[model samples]
Target: MNSSFGIKHIAQFILFVALQILLVDNLVLFGTGFCFIYVAFLLFLPIGISRMWLLILGFITGFTVDVFYDTIGIHAAASVLLAFLRPLVLNLLTPRDGYDTNDSVNIHVMGWRWFLAYALMLILLHHTAVFFLEKISLQDAWYTLAKILLSTLFTTTVMVILQLLFFSPKRERVDYR
Candidate 1:
């Protein structure tokens, strides 16, 4: 990647992580839903990013949150799982025309419907891992399931809003041939 691209991602990493720690962490709805907005950073990465780098970034992002939230390795594990599954998910959602290397997974680039599906799948998996790992008891299966579903909805909604508010729409590239 170019230096500017690397710099941009670094800035994004800091911004997302900081926002998660400072603002989104406390956003719990009805005591069952928790918004983990940091996952948006990993989800919105360039489409053609290497799997190794994606996994590494995911781990770092989640581990940083784990360090702050004192949740041990729950976040790290969930993030890694999300990263590992990301490419597969992209393939599953790939249009017949396929994706541009520079494209990002956002509402503007992929449309709201596609972005919603992508976010919902990844966030659900991430939340499942997180809640299951945090509370490994089948005794409260219903409660845990509710938490996962609610958290996924909350996180996905916040991600969509953030994309609309902060991220610019995809610019059409013109060829002057």
Candidate 2:
């Protein structure tokens, strides 16, 4: 919203879009359709960001992907849901002290295992929701579930890889005051 944050937001969003469109989008592993790293953008936002900002960021990120992939509103819907769920999930996962205003949702802070759990949870939720909704027009339950599960799994793997590859965000250790 402010000038400084505006720059960071644009940079981050562009990086997410680029990584997703240029890097992750091309990757397919063993014919499994493995990767959708763009989902990470929704999950990695700072904690305590306002609801309106979250939605706006979600819409921007999702719409960018939609523009590139021509997937209608599927990415937009899934990204928004993930963004909405992120704060709640982070709150539950964080300790009593809580994260800082500009803290990151990353393995360095959350621990690799917990980060993986968080990433997997968001990715699965987004992919499953989007995939299922998209498939609803033509596919039955089992078929939809299959598509969702496989796509979710593949996308999640790619998202995790990209998260680790780029962000390893530094965590600050604080001595209790």
For lDDT, the strongest prediction is 1
lDDT of 2 by residue, 4-27 (tens): 655665788788789889977877
TM-score of candidate 1 to 2 decimals:
0.95
What is every candidate's alpha-carbon RMSD to the true fold?
Answer: 3.1, 3.9
- Provide the overall lDDT of each model, using Cα atoms, as 2-decimal numbers: 0.90, 0.73
TM-score of each: 0.95, 0.80
At residue 102, give the lDDT of candidate 2: 64
lDDT of 1 by residue, 26-102 (tens): 88999999999999899988888889999999999999999999999999999999999999999999988998877
Q: Which residue pairs clash within candidate 1? A: none
- Once superposed on the true structure, which residue ranges of model 1 sit more than 4 Å away at CA? 172-177
User: How far does residue 168 in candidate 2 sit from its true spot (Å)?
Assistant: 4.1
In terms of TM-score, the best-performing candidate is 1
